[model samples]
Target: MRIDKWLWYARVTKSRSLAQKLATGGHVRVNKDKISSASKTVKTGDVLTIALERRILVLKVVALGKRRGPYEEARLLYEDLSPPPPPKKHAEPAVAVRDAGAGRPTKRDRRKLDAWRNDT
Candidate 1:
């Protein structure tokens, strides 16, 4: 079971091209080392660490798939080694503030400030 095929068969990615892209872009790792080749075979019990979106996934191969299949069948190809960690909360960027110690505003800043004052 090649890594890319397994990934597709497992429904981890939508298409083989996407899987190849991810692998080639150094997003997929085998035993912690990045693997770019899609043809790399993965055996049962092999651990894979994949980076998708914002989080990393750790999975263990449980079975080999000879062909791509339905979602239910594909899921049997691998076992999630560990449950994904909860998403970390991200604070929104703080609004920019003028530094009072700047002494004086630039011409543009003054105009903007005037507009803000008018709006208020």
Candidate 2:
């Protein structure tokens, strides 16, 4: 089954979009390498490493759910291979940077900024 679907059906993530976004952002791993697509196929015995909040979840696929099911049934889909990692050690959230001279950017300013950033 597709990794994202499995995640959703297994109740690992609340929604498929969240799962896809997490995968595409390099937060989800199969075995050890990052995966960036919801359609990536996974099978029984495959190990998945999921990074969430401040912890890492290591799971082994025990079965594939053919469809979305009840929470208890869904939990049967995978086995927790390792306990979640300890919460990140007192890390402060990154602060957002604001442009010094900007008093609310205009549409043209936004376009120029987009072009400049996308040029790379």
Candidate 3:
């Protein structure tokens, strides 16, 4: 089966054209050799390395599917060997909590504080 077709059937790519671009753009390798054509033939047991936009994927072809199917069916076509993603980072630290009435003082509270300060 064609490499692009296999990728699509295996659900590695969302569309056949994207798969074709992946192969032609040299983002796909079969058994460590780069593929320059989308029509490259693939067989069971062949290992594929695909570099997508966000992350890389390594899958071993288990079967050549007949059509584009649901995720469950597509998942059966390959054996994933990719590494896990790194942990996500946050923009800021966790928020700090304060006791009740510890937030902002009201106008009356401020007047009382002023009176206490003046008396002292």
Candidate 4:
């Protein structure tokens, strides 16, 4: 099956055109070989490395899909081998706030702010 069609059928991309772009733009690889065309053929057991929005995917093709199907059906098309993404750490709130249009701090104010910051 064509890589683009397989990607669409597997639900990796929202549209076949996007899959084409991804393939032609050098973001898709098959069996460690870079594919520069959407028409590249894929077969069962071929490993694919796909780069997407904020992550990378390593999948082994399990089947050549017959049609664009539901997520459950799509899930059967490939075996995911990518590692889980790292957890996000929530940043702590700012220790100080300044209102809009606030002018630059005076020398004394700067010293006081520095002292407060150091104390924390």
Model 1: per-residue Cα lDDT over 1-120, one tens digit each: 778888888889999999888888899888877897888888888899998996788898889888889988988878787675888898864533677798767899888977876776
What is the overall TM-score of model 3 with all chains considered together? 0.74
Clashing pairs counted in every model: 0, 0, 0, 0
Of 2 and 3, the candidate ahead on TM-score is 3
Per-residue lDDT of 2 in model 2: 89
Question: How many clashing residue pairs, candidate 3?
Answer: 0
Which residue runs of candidate 1 sit more than 4 Å off their true CA positions? 87-120
**Alpha carbon lDDT at 13, candidate 4:** 97
lDDT of 3 by residue, 1-120 (tens): 999999888888889999899999999999999989999999999999999989999999888999999999999999999999999887753433336879787798778877876776
Model 2: residue 17 alpha-carbon error in angstroms: 0.8
Candidate 4 lDDT score relative to the true structure = 0.95
C-alpha lDDT (0 to 100) for residue 91 of candidate 4: 88
Candidate 1: lDDT of 17?
92
* Residue-level lDDT tens digits of model 2 in 31-91: 8878878789999999999888867889999999889899999989999987845676876
C-alpha-based local distance difference test score of model 2: 0.84
List TM-scores for all candidates, in order.
0.67, 0.67, 0.74, 0.76
Query: Number of the top candidate by TM-score?
Result: 4
Error of 1 at 21 (Å): 0.6
